[model samples]
Target chain A: MDEPIQNKKVDTPQDNSDVITMRHIAKSFGDNAILKDINMDLHKGENLVILGKSGTGKSVTIKLIVNLLEYDKGELKVFGDEVKDLSEQELKKLRTRVGFLFQSAALYDSMTVRENLEFPLKRILKIKDEKELEDRIKEVLDSVGLPDAIDKMPSELSGGMRKRIGLARTIILKPEIMLYDEPTTGLDPITSKEISELIMSMQEKFKISSIIITHDIACAKITANRMMVMDKGEFVAEGTFEELENSSDDFIKSFFKL
Target chain B: MANAPAASYKGILEEAGNQVLFMFRFFRNIFRFDFEWEEFIRQCYMIGYKSFPLVGITGFIIGFVITLQSEPTMKAFGAESFIPKMVAISLIREICPVVIALICAGKISSGIGAELGSMQVSEQIDAMEVSGANPVQYLVVTRILACIIMIPLLTLMADALGFAGSYLGVNLSNHVSPQLFFSKAFSSVEFGDLLPAFFKTIFFGFAIGFIGCYKGYNSNRGTESVGIAANSAVVNASLWIIVIDGIAVQLTNALGY
Candidate 1:
């Protein structure tokens, strides 16, 4: 498959300063080193796609960015605050500004779609009024193009619809940065394209910076402003899609071959 | 290739040992009250309030059946008048708390284990941490608190219902009135029997919730681990309840209760 067009800059409403930066981040589970001395920068209003084969620490990197997984050694900054030193109260405040779409959608099975969307808003943001909560829920649902499915259970939604709802829930708080992990993994090709389109629309509409982690070359091509290829828990190459395609690195060449 | 089976068995045993160690660590964390008070309240609601009907029903049935069954047995010794005493002692000191623990082990333990297991498998727990929610405080404390509060309340309700059932059961064969039955039941139940029994249930509730939450929260691997967590939570909690109850019985006996 050919690489998607590389658009360096598209005019958007949000600022384009550095949104997230990691310096020498290292994480290990017991003796198993999952990430090692990793460094990366994610700019605001940019969709940076991280491409790696399975178990290459792609998901772990996303976790670290959100401060979900602690790094044994290294500094991580989100919107200028050092994430490691922040207290629990401070972290909850920081988390509200960031949105994440989990790979499995991670929608609470016991909750309805509306409750799922309302959960963080009510629990974390403490949005109490019924009228405003309903309005915000409808607004996010409409943005994700699923306004009518608010009363439905998660089990009732199709794979693609669930992913969209997950995306909607992530954006309900209007986070400044969106981290999507394998957003298109289990979808049909057409559904995958729809998800990609939705990602683009979100970027355009919200102008939020995004970090999408996936093994899908097609997804990386369509969604990324900048792309990084990872191998064995380390970044092997990084650039615009065109720049990476033209590189002499055998792994990058072969990765893009299919 | 020839050594694969032997190696796999060894690996399984090692994994089992590690799981036991993990359980010990979880106990340590619970004693430290790892999560916040608000989180504890939420878990109490989940474990206790949500499980009221099942626990209530179990308590009622056990009380009724024990009364009916003991009627025939006591009649053989012309001790049919002692039915209330027997039912009261059994419910307050043994059956009520133990049954509630077992029921909770089934309901709350499995529910917590499955909930946490799914959270772990689905990575919501991870998401919480990433989003700056303290997963430990958010998940662990709420559940532990729920167990502590709910278990005692459930036992209290169960104790009442069981006595009612025993009264009804006694009426089935004999003419013992509700008033006479309660009086006889109370006369046999001193503070010694009631205090230790009720007190031990708090620990029972705590054990079930803590072990279940611990199992589920730490669960990894894949879908199968969730089942393992649920299973282990119930097994460990029930075992601990029995062991703890036995110790309480011994201590009470030594203290001349």
Candidate 2:
């Protein structure tokens, strides 16, 4: 019963406080184009939720921001610096400023949770003192609500616990920006809600910007400050959650009715 | 369907090119500072020390079986006294190094392939990379260097064990003492024989480590690829070991080693 509004151009608010900006980004793997001329920006201290079906390149967008995957065309600038032009050392320094939480949490299986947290601290921060490492680890563990998990292996934890630990590892470096690739995927509803809440708390506590990619409506409702729904390698709609929820376009409204 | 064979050939050529490039990266990373000495030492223990029991057992059995099998032929020619000399020379110049390397190809290469493949499938390598940690320097370099150092030492141990097995085989049929058997065994093994064999094992180690790490590090994103990586690592490493052995033998002969 919604009126046709497909022709309406939802204006994205522009600001100088943007931490990540992708101008006309296009990426392809062979013949299959993942992102075709996509333009977006992640503003400072905002949770930007990208909702899309599987393989619509929502995850790919965040990956491009972190330079996990390179875009074939267009400008990708992080913190006002061009990403593709950075040298290896510069790129590494950039990566340290951005934290990425993969879908599987990607916790090193061979390492204990404490070692997992210690990895970035030791490697990137170069913190050599045992006491400092211990204090930082304790503080991060408390933040993630997993203090007892320090000595435990990743395999011993549940999916939610792994995601928490993964989040802990990401923020342990105190990154300015966070990229969460399907943070609440493959979890029970209760656990997913908890994770979404945790994401909000993390933004509040660390004062970090985030780009969260997910298909979970509940998660999007709880976490997204701004939402972008993508279809066929391009974002079809962009607005705040309430604006999108009541959008006149059927395609945009379809997301909320689920 | 018409281009199937050509496509397959192209794929193989592409694989070869990738492997060469991977080797180049390995050499380049070797000079980088912040070398992972702890991981390298750990890899040495895993790839080298843990392989002792299998290598030792295989070396012993090979020596024992060869002596038993060759005894009747030697007796027919009245060359029974030359048995120790023949076993010593053959085992040192060819048997011990090649056999032990093949064994390690099965053990070490396949292990690395599976481990790394799983790591890839699970995105652990990507995680490490995004964390600003150099995975190649940490994982690949340490493993390859461990293989290079440990394989030679393992071959030396296997040679000693092989000689002991030959001694036992000799005692099973004759009254020869350990002293006389060892004396005859070592008398013909010159530095010329040992050096080429030792050097060839180093190449074998490189092949095993290189192929395994390459297969694993570059595995496709699927659970099935883990098995493929492990299988291909073993098969390719074993093949490269034989090829390198053949080439080394020709080079040694040309140089009169």
Candidate 3:
């Protein structure tokens, strides 16, 4: 929030050590052009929120960095390596360092909350020590304000609880990069604000860089160190929350008016 | 409407191609480390042991009904003593395996289709992938292998129970001893007949698991698609079972069984 907002024409400082960089990235499906020459950079330990209405490629842009969807053209790099060029094994290894929280929280319904937490630990982290596993699960559960939810089933949790658990699961790996797709999309305002603050606090605690894709204005204001507004596959505004709020651009103004 | 037929044909081709590719991917990841032994055994319990009671009942009824219905005809031909042989051959070569598969296709395939379909809709699969997990290994391989192992084992149980039912049916009118019934049952059931019947069910099991996985894994992101996946799983797996049965019969017939 303290980061100085750059003017629309003035470029933000770019360093070679940026965790993720995208230049002139373009992606399309069939005849529909979703992303057109998009450029982005996520500095280490920064929360960069991309705000836009639905179908503007806000989520797709972040997804591209994880190589969930390939950029049709232009350059996209994660940890300075070209995403599309990575081998399958490399891509999988890269994904381990990048945590993605889906909109639904996507908890495995068949498993209890403890099993959900243990899944990535056992599967991805290959953590075998029972004591260490329990300690790590408890650490994340407490961080997300759900210490007692360890033994509960996912179906028993409410929407806000599920989101907290999802965040806990994502941050358990202490991923260098966290990708939140509509983290607060389907929750009450109080819950939404809670999630936004959780994201901010987690960023500070873990020193993780994040790309949060959402149209929730409160979410952007609370979580974003720098914010960008995307429309029709390209960024239209880029700055701090207050900077974008005070801008004269009609589109940017309309978003902040609410 | 001009391209409707072509589009339909294209969709089918694409699906077939994807399913084959899916099967290969399943095969590739199966042998890798993290074999999901716990999940595999759990699936064996669900898909195999849970299927036994139903298969047993169906097998018993098939044995009984066949013995009862064919008894009058065999009596007319003065081949009444061959009733056990008739029931055994039908149960082994045709009835038990095919019926068990159909029953399993209805139960297991639909259940898998719905479970995975709902998971897909909820984005759990993507969550697994994004978290650096092998979804195919954890989900598909365990379920498919469970089916491959379970279906055949269940079919064997069915074969044995069917003979019991046949014996009970035989005693309904005539008092036949257990020794007499079993001897006559195995009279026509040769080593050749048993081999094909035993081996053919592996294919049936594989088809049930594969088709169910294909349908459920690829189902679109909608609640309605869950139903579609389950329905289509049953339909496709049943067809695959019949087609495989036909092929096994042809192979056996060619071998002069």
Candidate 4:
């Protein structure tokens, strides 16, 4: 089988500018291999969408970038530092630079929207001034277009509103990299499109690199600078949305079929 | 067939080992210098303050019923004056702490277990970790420490209410004033009886918090695990309370307390 087009980029000269680099990465839980010798890169200031079926290790790959899950073999580097070699403090510092939006949004349900947003700002950034805390929270909530939701508990918010709040909470610290695990999974198409637009806008506003894992082709078309299609724990095809759409491979064409 | 029992034994040992490691991590996080005082105070309010009414009621019932039932037996033995002493020693040294701890195992342990389990199921704990916040420090240590501080205080309240209920019981049949009843209750009670029982309730508190936090924190990745964690926390904490009670009794006897 021919290599995916994205594998070609993995061979390019190592650049300090690339926010994340994974080479020959493999991971397994017991005998079940979840990722097998996959190579990938996230260049600075680009949205790299990974499209895969459920359980194809899409979530696991993004999890590895932040050291949420360890790779069993090969190398993963974030900001040129090998992920597995980082000390606990260094791992934590790396995590602060990267933001992850989980599939379920994963907001602290016990906390109101304002407290949820305040969590990272207080714990990681250690912002002590009440005035500063209030301002930052208001700013982030306003940017997400849910300024009225500051006092509402997570259970009180609609699904789309919760996702937006989750995004706001992650971006509050102004991270350099964002790993979105299905940012628009369960929402209606209109909300999904809006979230995808928000992802693009956030990229433009923050100038941060992103890796969006999704099966939503419409989302891939709207947000991906480049896209990789995963199959059976490996990258089977990779190109721009238009390039992959025009590819001769039937499996690649299946993703683009309306 | 022989392998089955061996496997079961190995599984239990492995679980015990994991619990020890979890406890060690809890201790390590306690000394990590950035104790979450705000969250600790909040947990104390939730775990300690909110649980007072139930404990108070149970204590009152235990004291009243024990006094009432023991009356006939005491009158038969021609030792009716010993009723207050008997209720006092029994409630303070044995019944109040054990019963109150068991009640907490059902209420606090199960509550913490389910709450944390649901948090785990929803991936909030993961979100905290990825955000570089210590979830153990924020969630586990605060809850356990709150249980430790609050359970003893709750037991103390139970002890007082138990005595009050006993006074009411004593008044129902006879005409002892509050002063006479309390003085009679304390006359036979010594520091030896108080110290060991009071000391054992502390262990009971620790066991309840530790088991609850451990079960909830390590719950598997499913909604079903939430219920399982809660059930397991209550059962294990209840069992630990009994085991600790037995050990305390043996130690007290050996030391001539």
Candidate 5:
């Protein structure tokens, strides 16, 4: 218990090309196929959304990118580094640059919002200066439009507010790539729209590439620069919001329908 | 119906393997880069401090009832005067520590399991992993280390209460001053009797924390798994407590306890 921790210092340089690339990505659970031979790419400063029905592996795709879920077969690269090939130290460095927002917001329920936001800061960035840490917390909270909710608990917030706080926690470290799983699921239409707009605002403000997996067309339409509609384990369509909306494919039309 | 046992057998084997791996990972993480001091203290408060009342009550009842029930038999043999000595030896050497551990397996282990399971199910564990903060160090190491520190402390407290309860039980039928009773109690108890038992509680602590963390941290992603993790944590931790007690007793005996 008295042993001091040996800090393993790590740093990965920023790149200008594709932030994430996947080819023939596949994952399965038992005998069921979740993602099958999927290929995708997210270039720098792009917002890519994968729209799919429930149980269609939308969340699985994003989880795979972060190495939270291992792909049965595929090559997944984030920031041009093969995800499967990265060492533990490299993976940790990669994760610090690519923030993931869980579907449930996944706030540390025990910690107040301030502590929750401070978690990644203290543990990951190892930020020691109190003034800089507080300033970062304030800035992220303000950007998410919940500056007053800093001292509040996640349990005290509504669904939308929790999502905003979740995003704030994710972005406080200023990651170059963000992965959002169902950013606006289970919210009212108005709140959903607000979250979609917030995602776009974060993209524009931080200039971070993001992969948002959602079922809500409103979310995709509002936030996605390009969208991929998934069916079964494969993407059935890929285009801009308007292109996918105007496409005659019945599968794509089903998602676009009100 | 035929496949049920086979499936269950496979499930048990899988769980055992996972638990072993979890234990290894826990040890590996503990000696790694950083320790979560804040979280560890918080877990100490949650696991150790919060568990006192229940473990205390359980230990007391155990000591009192064991003394009370064995009275007739001891008196039949005209050995009534040995009650305090007998109770003290049994309580300090085995009964109090084991019973308190089982009680903790129920209280502390289950709570750890449910908490970690819910965290796993809700993706908080994954979120922590992706955030570049070690969840194993933060969550598992903290909880386990808290138990390692706390279970002995709890066992020591429970042993004291058990002696007190036995004193109260002893006085119910016959008048004996606390001084006389403790003097008789301490007459038969040596450092040998206390040391092995006290030592075993550390393993009891490890068993409870490790099993609970294993069940919960490896739990599948479902709400049902939370309940499953908590329930399995208690069952497995209690089992491990007995197993560890057996091993500790054998080792102590080899050392001439």
Candidate 6:
């Protein structure tokens, strides 16, 4: 029985250190415990994948990190500031630095692709200079390799294209950290790979730290520098892909058996 | 599972309590948080400006038809002078606001519900929160505020259109001049009849927006939940409007208004 990987100690510049850290986190819906005593650290420029079977609270973990779901007990800190205690204005300011790609791509259907991408930029950031806004839109869209999708409605795009557009929207703010919630959940194998590759490429290009929640082993193996498997509301294993492959735990072994 | 009757009754009571709590929280949030002014303006545009054409057209047609249809009956009584006053009081004091609300309950409530339900299904609301935006303030508050501002304006427009329609209706039957008709209408209207009807619409607007947003915001299950949210929003909002209107009428009558 291999022991779980010891939590790594992250070295920070005397000036800057943790981007996000969660301590003793727990959440429940009625009597059902969704997450239990979760502790994790996300450092700068690291891609962390949370691998879990369906209904294992993988998405809940992401939601907790982003303050989407309030935890019953815990301290969640983003940029070394306590998230739960922040004022509304402070929360809005913090959001400018984080980008999230929702599971369904979650594009506003009433708006065009360009408008969807521009929504946060204009509404939240108040970027009124038309040329600069257009340039930013083009840059993000080009980075995701969908430069031509500007005028297209979300319904007009393919699943892969929509995910790419979602990625484009997520990175529009040039966030320091990105959260991807099952980014490839419903796509074909080929499209899923495209999304996985895009996720990796985007992380590398932007030097952005990421937490990706997915059930796709192929995606986890290809993109995660470090991976954690969660089962029944707790993390059972955490290690590099090679280290996890050599793990002897029945749950971990059987997970990758196919 | 075998507890049967007692357990089932308890479950029903629990569901009822939860609904009451939901409504209570929905109302509380409006006053508890500092109102977001920009969002309020945006909502006003959504609820008021966008809805004007539909409410306006409907009001006009209803008024005109009512006058045209009622002329013969009033003529038989030789009380043709009372046509404008009757139409004015009926439409302004009751019919117009309820009718506009029903139409809006269909249009705006369903729209808000479907939009929010899709967001819930797609995790967009979660995305907003994670992005450091308050999904409630950003989405729900703006919409409800828009209703607060827009619904009354719509009702007022409906009242005017109903009067115009009555004017046309009267002309079709008898040659009552516009001045004569309006004078008769004004003579019959008091502050009592006008104020309560107008005031009650604010509650109507709040109900429509609140229900639509609540159903949509809390929707779960999956893709189909959006449709269910939209349907429920319309159904619940229309029901609440009628209920509230009835209460308002009773209260106004009690006060001798």
> What fraction of the reference interface contacts is present in each model, in order?
0.47, 0.87, 0.87, 0.74, 0.95, 0.61
Off-target runs (Cα >4 Å) in candidate 1 are: A1-16, B1-77, B132-142, B164-179, B250-257
- For every prediction, compared with the true complex, DockQ reads 0.43, 0.84, 0.81, 0.80, 0.82, 0.55
A80-133 per-residue lDDT for model 1 (tens digits) = 667787776667777888899999888876679998888777666678899999
Comparing 2 and 6 on lDDT, the stronger one:
2
lDDT of 4 by residue, A1-258 (tens): 211223123455776667789898999999999999788988999999999889999999999988888999987888877889889888888888899999999999989998999999999999999999999999998888999999999999989999999999999989999999999999999999999999999999999899999999999999999999999889999889999989999888888888
Local accuracy of candidate 3 as per-residue lDDT tens digits, B116-182? 9999999898888889898999999999999999998999999999999999998999999999999
Q: Enumerate the chain B TM-scores of all models.
A: 0.85, 0.98, 0.97, 0.98, 0.94, 0.91
- The candidates' interface RMSDs, in order, read 2.0, 0.7, 0.8, 0.7, 0.5, 1.9
Share of native interface contacts present in candidate 6: 0.61
What candidate 3 gets wrong by more than 4 Å, as runs, is A1-14, B1-3
Best by DockQ: 2
Reference A-B contact fraction recovered by candidate 5: 0.95
Lowest summed lDDT window (length 10), candidate 6 chain B: B26-35
Question: Could you give candidate 4's per-residue lDDT for residues B122-229 as a string of tens digits?
Answer: 889999999988899999999999999999899989999999999989889899999888999999899998999889989999999999999999999999999999
What CAPRI-style quality would you assign to candidate 1? acceptable
Q: What is the lDDT of residue A173 in candidate 5?
A: 87
> Candidate 3: lDDT of A230?
97
True-structure lDDT of candidate 6: 0.84
> Could you tell me how far off, in angstroms, the CA of residue A55 lies in candidate 2 after the best superposition?
1.2
Each prediction's TM-score versus the true structure? 0.83, 0.96, 0.95, 0.96, 0.94, 0.83
Q: Mind giving the per-residue lDDT tens digits that candidate 5 earns over A122-236?
A: 9988997999999999999999999999899889999999999999999998999999999888999999999999999999999999999998988888899999888899988
Model 2 stretches astray by more than 4 angstroms: A1-14
Off by over 4 Å in 6: A1-18, B1-54, B68-76, B171-180, B190-192, B250-257
Candidate 3's TM-score on the B chain: 0.97
Give the Cα RMSD of candidate 1.
7.1
Kindly give the stretch of ten consecutive residues in candidate 2 chain B with the minimal lDDT sum. B32-41
lDDT of 6 by residue, B85-200 (tens): 89999998899989999999999999999989988887778666665545676788778878877898899999998899888888875787888989999899998888999899
Ranking by lDDT: 4, 2, 3, 5, 6, 1
